[model samples]
Structures are given as C-alpha cells and as structure tokens.
Target: MACQVQLILAIFAALLAALPFLSLNSFPIRRLLYPTCRCFPGEPCWPSDESWDAFNKTLGGKLIKTVPIGAVCHTNQSFVPYDAAACAELQAHWNEADTHVSSPSSITAPFFADQSCDPFAPPSSPCSIGTYVQYTVRAAGASDYRATIEFAKSNNIRLTIRNSAHDYFGKVTGAGAIAIWTHHLKDINVFDYASKHYTGKAAKVGAGVSMSEISQALKQQGLLAVIGNAPTVGVAGGYTQGAGHGMIASRHGLAADQVLEWEVVTAGGELLTASPSKNQDLYWALSGGGGGTYGIVLSMTVKAHPDEPTATAFLQFNSEGISTDLFYETIATYLHNTLAITDAGVGSIFQLSSAYFAVVPILGLGKTKEKIDELVQPTIDALTSKNIPFSYESTQYNSFHDAYAATTVETPVAFGQLGGRLPPRSDIEFSTTSFTGALRTIAEKGGLISGLSFNVSRMPDVPNSVLPGWRRSTISLVTGLIWNNTDWNANLEAQRIISEEFIPEIDRVSQQAPSSYMNEAAAREPNWKSVFFGDNYPELLRIKKKYDPSGLFWARTAVGSDTWVEGSDKRLCRT
Candidate 1:
C-alpha cells in the first residue's frame, strides 16, 4: 500500500512538472484539442434532441434527420431497416439524376458524397450518412428560410442550400451541416412584368423550379424563358446565378441577362427584393455571383420572350473509315466555324471522343430548316471531302420548347471529374492549329470532350457579375475523366489528369485569362478568384461580406470561400 501510494504521487508530480511545458500549439495536441471549427456530430456543442425538437416545431415539423436512401440496402443500419425490393429499385436508378435530386440529402455528384452509403455495395456493408447533411429543413416559404438561416447561424452550424442537387462541384452538400432543402418550393407565376428598368412579359419562378417545368409552363403561355441546356437544372438556383447558358443563348442572352428581380432571404433573415432599382449591389452579385453565397433565394422574376419558331439539326460521324489525322482535320474545320454559326444567330452542343463526334442539336432561333442547313453545310462538306460516312437530320418546330424537347440530350449523372475552359473567339479564329491541337491532346489522353459554342456578345448587355470571359468567349469546353466507383486510385488519377493535364493544354492557346463556368469546373481549380468571377471578384466579395457577414452560407470555390478552410475532419473552420 505504501509503495502504491508513493508511485501514484510520483506520477502526479511528473504530470504537474510536465504541465508547464505542455502547450496547445504543440504537434498533435493542437489538432486534437481546441479546434476552432463548426460544431460537428458527437461534439458537445452539437445540438441536443430537445433543441432539435424545438427547432422542428419552429419550422412547423419540417426538420428531417437524414436517412441516406442507400440505407435501404443495408440491414445493419438502426435508422432504416433493409428491404430487398426497395434496394433493387434504388440500385436501378442510382445513376439517374432524379434519384438524387428528389432525395433530401443526395447530390448528383457522388464523388462528394464520399460513397458513404452506396446502394450497390454489399448488402451487409455498413451504411452511414458520411458527408451528407445531418438534418434538412424542407423550406417552403420565407419563414422557413429565415428560421433555417437564423438557426444555423446561431448554432454555428454549416448551412447548405440545395435545390434539385444538380451541382457538379458538390456545392449542394456538406459534412456535419444542416441543409435547407428548397426542392418543394415549386411555385410558378407568369405575369406582365413592369419594372423601372424595362417592361415586358416575365415569369416568377420558385428556387426549386426545374428548367423543364418552367419551359412547359411558359410554352402554355405562348412565352419562353432562357433556361439551362439540361432539363433538370433549377432556374433560380445555381444555374441562373452562375450565368446559365442554353440553346437560344445567342438569340436571347444568358439567363442572368434576363433577370429583372430576385426575392431573397438574407443572412439576417430579412426578405428583400433585389433589382436594378433596389438593392442594386445584391442584384448585381446574385445575378452571376454564384449560388449559396449571397443568400437563400426565394424566387426570381425574369424577362420572358414571346414563343418563336425554331430549327434544330443533328450530325454524327466517326473514325471508322478515316485516318486519325483526317478525323482531327474534319473536327478542326467544324470548330473553326463556331463564330460564324453563332454570328448567324445559331447555337450548338456537341460531344467528341477519340473515335466519335456527334452534334446532338444545332439551335437556330427565328430561322428555318434551310437556314440551319446552310449554317452546317461547311461541316458536312468537311466530312464529305474526307470521304467520312455520317448521318444528318433537320427539323423545324413551331416553338422553341418543341425543338428543345426533341434535341436536348438527357444528361445523366456522371460520377467523374470535369475540367473546363472558355476559349475566346480570337483564339478559335486566329490560333486554329493550337486550339484544335489542345483538344486532340485531351482526347488522346482518354478524356471525353463536351463543347457548348455560342456568342454571349450577341446578347443584350446586362451588367452582372458573370465571368467577363463569357462576353468575348465563343465556347465552353469541358473535359470529363470518368473512373470506376470502387477504385480510389483511379478517381484520384482522373482528378489529377483534369487539374494538371487537360486545363493546362487549353490554357496554352486560350486568348483570355484562365476562366471557366464555375458550376462545371475542376475541383482543384487554381486561382479560382479570377478563373470563375474575373475582375468582378473584388466587388462580389464586398457584397458577400455586406449580406452574409457571418459567412452563414458557403460552398466549394464560392465567393469569399478562401476565408475558411475545410479541416481534416471535414469541419469547416477559419483559416
């Protein structure tokens, strides 16, 4: 007993002596203790059940504890019991965008989802929420938005705003955060819009309104609004705020150019209207400043144009009978005429692979079938000259909606990495060799190339914070590197190739400074400030500070995101 008491006293003395030297800044101690981060799950600061229950009551019982849809595949999960039938259904639709969009916590980009609860994994494999938001508030109105922002801010919880979850950069999901799911806020109203800036027909759409829904609604009213090329993208969310482009962008302008007013709930929980005449800075920033940065958007009233006749065409060719050099030459010829086609009031989207090239649709607004044929004849001639066998089709529709429905390829949710660049007209017209050579280099590297070519310069100039590169830019080229879901090394290599290989090749010949569509860009983009927002970044940052002083909203590569760093544990903390 005496010996044991002496040993205990000696250990206590040693600990007390070492306590003087112990420091919070020392090695692993700093990381393990006193981490200045947002409250994470299992932490004492995390909200209690009583607090959550009270908050749910405040939201009118809208709060939902996240249960990953994949839970249906795993029997071990306590929150969800496995069901064989439901698991089969989920596995079938795992790759579809709607499967994720319709869910409260799922995002289209699985890479960001951390593969936490993959439905296709072994049925016995454990299922956890992983990086998905822990709680979601299905926000239906301004009150819900206000309550969510206030609660997240007060609780020091990371807040994510998700509508449709069609984000490519994982902007719609965050770990240890609570989300305001605006998916059910599907309100649409069409009216004769009159504003101080101008007067015209317009539609007020909810944040959750998808492009397909708005198009169908407006088509019935004999009007149309500039929407995303993809049918599932939300109009008033990231699509428009990131300066949405569509088939008719050359004729009408980007979706940002069409905006007349925005109804948003600020970080202070004050609902405000942003337009040219009121809250002008917020209006300017929100138009193209990137979503989930400024505030939670309730709805947007945008200018709608009268429905018009449109012509659509499709062209497809491959390298079956042609030499590699000849195939590239044919592609080069078509790419060189991008400016001319857009100048003639036509826009087009095409897919290019090492062995295949297909222009799914060429949009000719206010033009006839013959006009579209004339515009595409040069490309057809190129293929003919090379003796390349191909197929071409053309059709004229009474409305843009009809043409869009026929030609718009249903974009599936791809689990891959995407790197993008906006090659200006000057480069395509002058440095033709270098421009096409870069694309060939990327394709040769097993990268799939997707191109959207148009002239935003042709649109009515509306001052917004969209990438200035869009003004002079003729094409937005995205290079995709897909990898198997189970292979971590392959995924890392794919991302590395896009960040280190594909983008640099294009930059060599790109006339403008490095710029890309923020919504569809590299995960590890360098100098994102200038690349995504350009000279407008400084002003955008100022507006972000003014509206969201607490940094209540954040996303990957968003405005002022540099102010914080996501920790090793995925808890966002001040750098």
Candidate 2:
C-alpha cells in the first residue's frame, strides 16, 4: 500500500508539472486550430491555416514561408527561419511572451541588427500606438518588386526596404511587419555614357551596390564618383538619400547633385524615371527628401569624374594654451580663407578635440608639394598666425581614389550589427545650427570645440538645388564639443546643454544659411521636416500620403511621422 501511494504521488506531480504546457497550447485554442498568430492590443489571436496557405500561393515561388508566432517573440537574436526544428524551438520561446496569433501571409517581420535590445515596437506613449506584425519578404528584381508592392497594398500590410541596415535611427527595419530586404538587387550597369549626356564617363548603378563595390568598379574604368568614406554604405540608397558628401564634394558637389536620372518605384507601384527632364517634382524630392519617404529607388545615374592626381595633408594641433577666443578666431579665419579658395577646388575637413585638433585637407592637384601648398596655404596661415602649436604632414597620391584609400578611416560595418556602435569617443552630439561668428567669443572664454565642415561650393549651380535648410549661405560649418570626462549621464547632459545653448547662438549669426545635411541633423529634433526638407516639406507630405495612404510607414523619427509638424522650428528634446 505504501509503494502504491508513492507511485500515485509521483504520477500526480508529473501531471501537475505538465499542466502549464497543456494550458499554453490549449487555452489559446486559436494556436491549435490555426497556423498563424496575430496580436492585437496585447493578446495572441490565431488566424486560420487556410488563409495562410492562400497567401503563400500568392507569393509565387517558395519565398514566402510560415513560422509559429511563438517562435519569434522569444528569440533575442535575429530570427531567420531555416528549418522546422529551429522554428519549433523559437515558437516555444515565443510562447512565453504575450504574442498574438496571426497568419504569416498578412504579417511583416522587422529585421533587427544583431545587438538590438528594444522591443520591435515603440511603447504606447504620448505620440502614437506602435504596431507589430509578423510577415517578412525579401524582394529583388523587377518582378519581385511589383509582386511585393501589390501584395502589400492588397493586404493592407506595412512594408520597409532594408539593404545594409545602417540607418542610425533604426528606420531600415521594424517589428511585426513585412521587411523587403534588397541586398540581392546588386547590379552595376554602365549604359551609353555619351547618350546619357556624359561629358566624360558616368555610370548607372543599381540601388543594392555598396560604395566599396562601386569604388572598385570605377577604379577599373579609370573613373571615380563622390562616395562616402565608409565602404559598406549603399551607393544608391545611402548616398542618394542623405545628399552624400565626401572629400571630393568641394570639387564635384554632392553625390545627389551629380544625379542625371533615377529609376524609382512610386507609391502607386509604377516603375518610373525622374531627372531634370522627367518627373521633375520627384527629381527634386529624391535629391534630398530623406530615405524611404517618397518611394523605393531602383537605380541612379550620376556624374562621374576622371581619376586625377591628388595630395592629402594631415595636421594635428594641441589646444593646450589656446584660449577659447583665439581658437574661435582661428577657426573663423580658416573658414574665411577656405571659402576664398573654393575656386581652387580646395577641400578640407577639420576634426577638433578638447585638447587637440586634426585637419585632413585634400587638394585636387598634381603630386607636387608646391601645388598642394598653394591650395592649402591660406587656412594654414590663419592657424599659424594664431600661435596655435601644431604639427603637419603631407602626402601625394596618383589620384583622389588612391588618396582616400590611404587616408580616410574605414568605419566597420559589423559594428552596426552591435547595437549601432556609438559615435566616435567624443562628447559632441549632432545639431543643425547655422554658423555665425559666435566662435570668436567662445574661443576667448576657453570653451571646448570640435567638429567637421565641408565646402559644397563646387556643386553644380542648379536653381533651387541646395539642401532645404541650406539656402542662407555658400559655406556650411559643423562644430561640436568633446568631453574628456566619462561621467555618462553628466557627459550626455553637457552635450545637450552645449548643443542647445551654442547651436542657436551659431544659427543666430548665420541666419541666412544653407539647409542642414540630413546625415548630421540631430535625431531628436521635432521639426525635422522643415529642418531637412525646407521648402520641400509640403510636396513630400503629399507624396507620402499618396503612397502610404494608411500611414503604415509611420514610426519614430521616420519620414512621415506626425511629430514633424509644418513650422515647429524648435528643438524637440533637451537630451
């Protein structure tokens, strides 16, 4: 009788232990009966298997597959379904979370970087209730593009296109939705160069091609294009959308300014070409309308320049004895002289430090010290006159491509997979401030100064072609602060205080300045629409509404969020 009682107790404990799993699978009866799960508000509601099957058939090919909603919710890493066992394991993990049952057909999965920790959707906050759905699509080529857009419209699903996934604001991918990964659309086509009105030699490149690949291709052709310093940044998507500027921008203008034409898929699902001649409205919009706002760009035809001999100089200066006033005066003089030499096709970037400053000036000249000096001397003279202690070195290369390859630091792409690596170890935060002469006083007061400024004077003189907020001036200056202390909260607070206090001071000086470069604009600004688009905001809004009538693309700091009201020109957050 004792042995029998012990056996009965053991059986009862085992049964009790299994109860949670049983209820987990059965309480949400939808999970057992349906193949997909949808979450509304907070609960997991299951969708019928038949609906999922029907949706899969519409995707053509085996490209669209279903995974248990439970599998996705629990995994911390990027969830790419490769097999059933993995899917089951993922589902079991996901079952522990508050997930809804929804068919994969109607769902769009958000692609995340490897180290991301934020829940895919924004919490219910003062702004809007973020949505999370579970369908993902990787579309490439013309046919896939059409099908993807059509399916999205038919199902009222939200879609986001991701290539290198390098967007700083997490705009490239999202949660609980379909993601159209375009990394496979890597094609480089050199059309009839002369027919495209190429005075020298230019090429039409696909959206998926990266700067590194394009740089190599152009090198083979003895040609070069204005590309960003980072090799991994996508040429068509990154460069075109951000109004890409580079070391050569002062000589050739912005990457977008060189665009001859662009093949884009509009909100209406039509593949169309835009240029100065065709779809003029879109041409203006795409020039610097910011990414994924108007439409998906398929390809771009941009101006190319012949490879020319070039020289690069690197100078370092210790700000040890420099007063804040002296530093500001010196910088002001440097800007004045730099602008005066704009016609010489001289471009220089100054990286400041709290205790030091590094200047990398690229001169478009032959491999001769005299030519290089002639290009760089004015700004160098200003620094020397200020009695600023500094060291200088120079090197000449066969071409600008070679010079860039040798001098420009390569930013690591994999770091992006690690929760978007923090900006260089500087105390500065980006701000959209017009440069005025306030630096003279700041320099006298011994304030810290560090940042970069690029001259875009060589950009083609296209009417209304400047960046929206940049209409006030010919030269744009980017100034920042460097914090030497590691008090995280205090440093952050200092950065905010510096940005808020000083940027407005600078902008007050350069009241008539050019538009802010979208790449450098503060992500916290509420009036980013006016700050980025300038006069083009109304048109962008119209196009956005046309393509995303349901406003599915709305996300934090995205192109079409309501936070960017028309004329709210004040900074949004303090930190």
Candidate 3:
C-alpha cells in the first residue's frame, strides 16, 4: 500500500507541474472546455473578418492589419511587387530607430519580433508575422482608446500598448495579438497650469509625443521638462512610467516626479483622470508602476521649468597606449568621483569596455563651460598625470536645447539583451572593492557597461510607485551581451549570462539591496518582482488587480504578469 501511494503521489506531482504546458497542444478542445485561455489567430474564438471590420468602422477606419516591414522583400508575403531597391534601402536603415518608430507595427527591438521577417534574408525565404502584433489601432484620441480596450476585453484577445516602439525589454511586441499604436497622437498643449496644490507652467502632452517634439514645443514657450537621452522616446509612455532618468535628473528629479496629472482609459473602458487628490491609488500606480499594466494613458500633464543655460562635456580614451588594467583603473577613479559629480548637479551617460572608455556627454544645468571643466578636472588630472592619451571637450550653450542638440548621439536598436542594477551610493562610497571587481568582471566578459549617473536623494517625498532604489541610487549600471539574430544557442547562452552571471555580480556587493529600472532590465531577470519594484510590488499588484480584475494587461515583466505564460507558439495564456 505504501509503495502504491508513493507512485500515485509522484504521478500527481508530475501532472501538476505539466499543467501550464498542457494547453499548448489540443488548444481548441482545452479552450472550449475551460474558456479561460486568451484567443489568438486561427483559434475558434478569434474575431472574424466582419468583427474586425465593425471595430474598424467604429474607429473611422483607423484599424491596421500588420504587414511586416521586410515583406517587401518576400513576393509571396508582400501585397505589392517585390522591389529590390526598397529592400536594399530597408536593410541599410534597419538599425536606425526612426525606421521602426515611423511604422505602426514595427518595434525597435527585432529580437522580440522573432525575426519572422528579415529584409536581409533572400527573397525566397519565408516571411511570416511571427511575434509582431497582428493588428494595430492608430489611436487618435480617448474614444479610440476606450473602444479598443472594450473590444479587447470582450473578445478575450491579448492586448498590447505601444508608443514610439522604443522598448528594450520586449514589452511592446506580442505574437498573434492586437496593439494600440499611439504614435500618431501628437498633441502638445502648453499653458500656465494651476491647481489647488500648486500653480505653474506645465505641458499636457499626448501619449504619442516624443522627447524631441516635446522639447521643441516647451523650448518655444521658453520652458523645459525632464527628457530622456533618446529624443525619439515618447514622453508620456514607458519612459516616464518607468521613472524616467536623464541628463538633468540630478538637477530636477525623475520624469515621474514631474507628472501632475494623467488622463487615462481604464480596463473597463472608462476615461478618468489620475492625480494626487483623485483616484489616488491609480495615480500612484500609473506614476512608476510601468505602462500597459494599469491603464491606457492618453496624455500626461507635467511640470515645466524655465529654460536655463547649460554646459556639456565629452571625453574619450582607448587602450592603444595604456594597459587594460590601467584603463580600468582610470574607470575606477572616475567611478569613485560619481557622487561628487552628481552632487554638483551634473548628469552623464558613459560607456566602458576592456579596450576603451567614453563619456558621451555630461550635462551641467545653469553652469558655464569653465565650471563643467572644473567638475571633470580630477579625472583629467588623473589621466594627465598617468600619461594616458585622451580627448576632452566642454562647451557652454545659450540654452539647454542647444546643448542637448550638440550632445545627443542617436543610438542603434534591437542589438542585444539588457540587464542592469541601480547601484546605491554605498557601493561607490563604502564597498568600493567589490563594486570595482564586479564592473571589471563584466567588462572582461565583453559586456558593455553603460552608466547613467545622477543624484535623486533630494527628490521630494511623494506617493508615486517608482523603484524605491532610485532615490538611493547614484548610478544606473547596465551591461549586456550582443548577439546576431540567427544564433539560437548563442543567444540563449547570452541571455543566461546576462541574467544569471553579469547582474548577480553587481547585486552581490550592493550594500543597499539596489533594484533595476524596469524599462531596461533583463527580460529573464531573477526575482523580477523584487528587482523591479522592491517593497512597492505588493501594493502595485494590488492596484493592478483592482483596476484590471480580469487581467486585461500583460507584459513580460510588468506588474502582476506571472499569472500568464507564453507558450512555444508565442500565444499568451492564463497559467
């Protein structure tokens, strides 16, 4: 009897473990019996042609069926004749971010798109939609947002939200899913904003507004708001929702901190405003809880400050004349002075490798070029005294926009997986040995260490739900493995190293238990709930459940996403 009982228990345990995977096969029967799984293309419950037509009509013909951008190269897949010239042009500009952002369905990260469509492939090769969203709604306003949410909910289809498509962590693309593309909602309204709590100049920017557009609009009004390094990044989307940090973060605060109000469309298709005094929980959740989870934000009203003079610095050095050890040592010296640099209200974006070091640009709000040079003097002196060949430049501009234009360097997209940690001040101040060792190990592994350093210790005590680590962190350190799209085995190993090896090296020595910025964190990060939100995750989850009770929103690492699982077919189903 005991032997029989043991066998039964083992069998039961195996079945329980296999439950999530069971739905992958015979999905039609399983879905019919349970009716709990999300509907996808070719499924019995998927929306029919008439249903899609009706929905499109409601939006005044705004619905779009995705045609993979690379389809132009595949005659069988493309609607039009294959044009070799167009295919060549697409291949040439594939890495440029603007190429993807301009399209309704193309996301900047092609890895997430699963390479189902590749312009580089021979014309005879297959070109399927793969992981790209099957259909997109060019949401022009609130009514469109509401209708899309209602349709998604009633149809039991996986819904995705995308703006600018600048996602690094695969949050925007979903296979066999429908997405609301907010890239065309470009309305920027600047005014003298006044409320019961405070009064000032603010801009109510539409969800589609990019950093470049908003900066230009605000500059025209002789004002500025916190913006990210990428000008193409949307102002009211994932950037701010993930607690935006930028070149002036130390001078102001996070972009989330600048938000005064959010106009959103909820999961239930109701339009509402979220702010400190109204829908308080929704306000907190939307501020930094990560986008596409809480609601579909239509626009955000953010505090704008008067334009100011700005200075910037650029520095670069390579290992041509210096030893690798000496190069890292120079990097260490620079890292050691991060606290002082940020304290002086300077913010910077820098990169490191075993063979080179570069500070793309450092912003000094209201500071002159002389002051900028003084702030970097210690690192310059260290390089000079050690006879390290280097190039450095500091320039002052009449306005912050001019400085931004001069310093901004466009970056490529969809190249690799990203993993990072927000290293608290203690790591640089007290636990210097372990911190330095971690960075060295990463660089030795060919991981690019991109550091965005700033001081947020002075951020006002507010109720937003950003990673608590942000306030205590001095630098956000990101390192990752770059992989060519065709290598599955190599890509798997790269993901494992970044999630399991590279990030852990930094986590082990972090004295304050620092977390990661959700927007740039690794896709498979361990203990992601804690790594992304820390102590605030529980509350964020509670708010997610309350607002989206049926679990209408799901992203890879967004709040409360563990309940759903993606199968081999790339379909999202309830676990």
Candidate 4:
C-alpha cells in the first residue's frame, strides 16, 4: 500500500513536471512514458513479453497479440502450407475494398489513417509490426468495456475504442496500444424511451449496430431512421459521433440530432448515461463534437420516426456532345435551382462525373411528382437547350428502405482520400455573376455532392454541440482523388493533393474559414477544430477535459488530440 501511494505521487509529480514545457505545438513526454518512467521504446523499460502474458491472464485470455493480416505473403513457415496464389489474393482484397478490411472489428483499412503502419505498406517495403494495437479485448458486454478502461487507467496505457472499424479517419486501431473492440456488443432494443430531457418512441442500439441493420430492423416496425448513405456504416459509432448526414437529414435532421441518450464508459472507469439532461456535457460532446474521444459508447437511444411514403428520383445526364463551357453552365444552373428543390421538401446526393446523377431519396414527400419536376425544370431546361442526352426515373416507395434499395449507387472502396466542405446558401443561389463563377469553380473540381435543404427554419429545442454551420449550409460538398491501389506512390500523391491543393481550392471558392463534416473530412485538415465543430469546439474541449483529462482516447485529428502525431514507426509520438 505504501509503494502504491508513492507510485501515484511520483506519477503526479512527473505529470506536473512535464506540463511546463508544453505548448500547442509540443506535447508532454509523460503522455507517452510507460510504467517504468522511461522516455524511449528501446530503453529496456517497455512492457515485456512476460508482462503481456500476465495482463492476458488478468483478462481471462482475452488479450490478442498483434499479427499483420497480410503477413501470409512474407511468412509461409510455422503456420500453414505456403500458398503464393492465396497470399496474392489476400493482398488484393486488402488493397481494393474498405469493407473487407473494415469487416473484422479489429482490422482497420490501410488508407483510413495515414497508412503509417508498415505492415500494410507495399510489398517492396519490408514487413514489420505496425502502429496497430498489439492486443485487443473483444468486448462482448459493458462489463468488458469497464474492465478494459480500468486496466488501461491503472497501467497508464493508452486506450482505443473500436466499433465496426468503418471510420474514414481510422480511429479504430492504434499501435503499441490495447484496444477494446465493441463490435460484438450488438444488443438492439425497442421500447418507450422516457428521459427528464426527452420522451419518445425510440430504439436503443448497442455500439456495434450498423446503419443497414438499423434500417432493415426499423422497416419491420414501419419506421424510418436518418442514416448515412452507406449501408455498412456503424449507426451508433463514429457516424453519429461526427454528426451523421443523409438524404433524409433535411427533415429528420442529422443522425446525431436523432439521439435522446447514450450509455458510455468514461476514462475515469465509471459507466454513465449521457443525455440532454443527464451528464449533459458528455451528451453534447457525443452528439456532434467528435467520436473516439469522450468515452466508449455502450448503446444509444434515438428517436424513431414513423415510416412515410418517399418520392424517389434517379436522374442522369451524359457528358458527350456538351461543350465543357456548356457543362459548366449546366452545373451552375443546377446549383441555382437547389434553393427551390430544397425548400420543396427534398434531399439528394449529386455526382459530377462522366454521367452526372442526382439521386433524391426522400423527394417531394408531402407534394406531388409534378411539383418535384417543376422544381427541377430549370436545370433540365438548360440540359435540353444544350441538346444533352439524359435519363430520368421517378417512383414512390412505401419506405426509405425500398427507395434506397431501388435507387442506391454503390461506391466501391479504392485507394483514395476524401475532403468535404459545407457550402453556404448564398453561394448556391444568390444568382450574382461572382456567386455563379464560384459555384462553377467548385463544381469544376468534380466530386460527389451530398446535401440538400440546409435552410432549417427552426433549431433543436435543446442546445447541443452539432456544428453551427450545418444549420445554414446548403450543400455538403466533397472532392476526392482515387488512385491505382497497386501503385503506392500514387496513393501518397492522392493524399498530398487532397490536403494541399483540392481542399484549399474548395475553401477559397466557398469564401469561408473552412468547416467540414468531421467523419468525412481529411485527416490532416489544417485548422481542424473550428472547421469540424465550429463555435462548439471550445465547449466540447471543456467536456473532453472534464471526462478524459488524461487524453486516454486519441483518434487521429480528433478533438483535443493535438499533442501527438503519427511517426514513421507507425507509433504515436509527442509533437
């Protein structure tokens, strides 16, 4: 007991000692110092194999040693019969699709983070252990999450919360760390949700539940959920954490806006409930401030809307025969008409490629098909005047599930990077020559556009942390670069251009200080705090300090994660 007290005192002293040298650009060394009070990995003080074994025993053999999922290619001995063909196929699968790698709760896609982990590097690079978590506790229940948090806290080790592994920013895995995988905690319950702050018919879903699972499950109850377009995304994970947006968001608001409460385990090793009334700060932080930062989410109760008939529009125009100038004018015209379309109760995802498409999911929900057509006539007129060939389809569905199933376009994963922006309404339809020019400049960048009806007339009854700009923004604009997976240089180049070139251009044309959707934005975005959370960032940081002062949960580019950066070793280092 004496020794334990002394140890605690020493640690506190060390932390205070490390604080004086700290600045926004520099992190305290104590942040990374392990149990032995060491400063470096090779100084004989790092956690040893014996220590790991003991830790494993404490968890009842739940500790998992890290292995490169792609190691089959390099090592054929001591495991299985060497199959070169099989190894090559595995690499191909890992390279091309986020779904394959993101499938395993512990297996994060390579490109999601900085791709700093050497294990997922090109074949030419020697295979080595990456910055990935050395051990993961496959948490099946809340008790497991609590235990992991306590263990990490006592040991002064970093903790990472992983659910679904679908984060575009790769918050799921961290090297030299122990992970709590919440993917198996898939309990979804339906009941009358009553809270001091809110009362409604709601579904309380475990942290691991995906958007598709929720959508399909709600379909059985004749209900609708405002979920991201991708079916594979985790509904209760980073999606909600980063203020989830979708085609139906204009009506129901963001997925985060749908939350009534959350069950969470904080860094203090206490399981708590966060809601509009209970633990309100944590609730605000979890609502839209960011994910993998506040605490490990056990489950979330969200308001459920009764399913309604949806008018779906699937329209496409070919790029051939139209001059580049005419195409630019067509895009400007489309932006010009967004105000009326958005006002008429519609939400859409527009693609600007060889064959441009605007797939409106909840189209003219309270109006007629003719009304929807009239709203879109200006753009159609421009296309027709240019003699542009186009295809069009309009139908009504009993549920959003049916509409999405019939009209959804699959976006296959590739070696790519994505950067997003929320374009102000004035840019969309102010109709001035400069505004038109700015819209053209933005569209000329040519990427997927997912936004509609940001002209919200009313705000949420209770104040929370969802980014302030989302209430006024007209479109959620995205610009990205997809490259050949086999060529790693091209992958690196794509990331460079996304941050250095494309994002700046988007910011310039929009004439804003750059705000982005946290989940879908670039990992290395400059001035990320205000850009992701806007005026809410400072309050969110206060909540983070209150809940996780030790900075136990760190996702790359997450709120309050500035003290550390990823090193070439794939390990996180003090800045």
TM-score versus the correct structure, for each prediction: 0.93, 0.69, 0.92, 0.86
Candidates sorted by lDDT, best first: 1, 3, 4, 2
Model 1, 368-408: lDDT tens digits are 99999998999998888878999999999999999989877
Instruction: Tell me the lDDT of candidate 4.
Output: 0.68
Ranking by TM-score: 1, 3, 4, 2
lDDT of 4 by residue, 368-471 (tens): 56666777788778878878877676776766777767765444554456777876676565643454454445455554434444444346766668887777
RMSD list, candidates in order: 5.9, 12.8, 6.2, 6.5
**Candidate 2 stretches greater than 4 Å from native:** 1-136, 194-200, 321-325, 363-368, 382-387, 412-454, 457-499, 546-559, 563-575
lDDT at residue 386 of model 2 (Cα atoms): 70
- Looking at candidate 2, what is the lDDT of residue 526? 47
Which should have the higher lDDT, number 1 or number 4? 1
Worst 10 residues of 2 by lDDT: 418-427
Task: Compute the lDDT of residue 429 as modeled in candidate 2.
Answer: 13
lDDT of 3 by residue, 1-575 (tens): 98986786566456646885543224343344437567878865677899899999999999999988988877667555788999989888887889999888887766687767777666877788889888999999999988988888767778999999988767788987889998888899988888776589999999999999999998888899999889999999999998999999999999998899999888888888998888989999989889889889999999999889999999999977888778877887888777788999889888987778899888998899999898888899999999999999988899999988888866787677778899888898887767888988898988888999999877554579888899889998889878665675787788889988899889888886659898888878768899889999999999999889988888888998989988998888788
Candidate 3 structure lDDT: 0.85
Model 1: residues with Cα > 4 Å off, grouped in runs? 1-35, 458-461
Better TM-score candidate (2, 4): 4
What is the Cα-based lDDT of residue 475 in candidate 1?
85
Backbone Cα, N, C clashes tallied per candidate:
0, 33, 0, 2
Q: Model 4 compared with the native: what TM-score?
A: 0.86
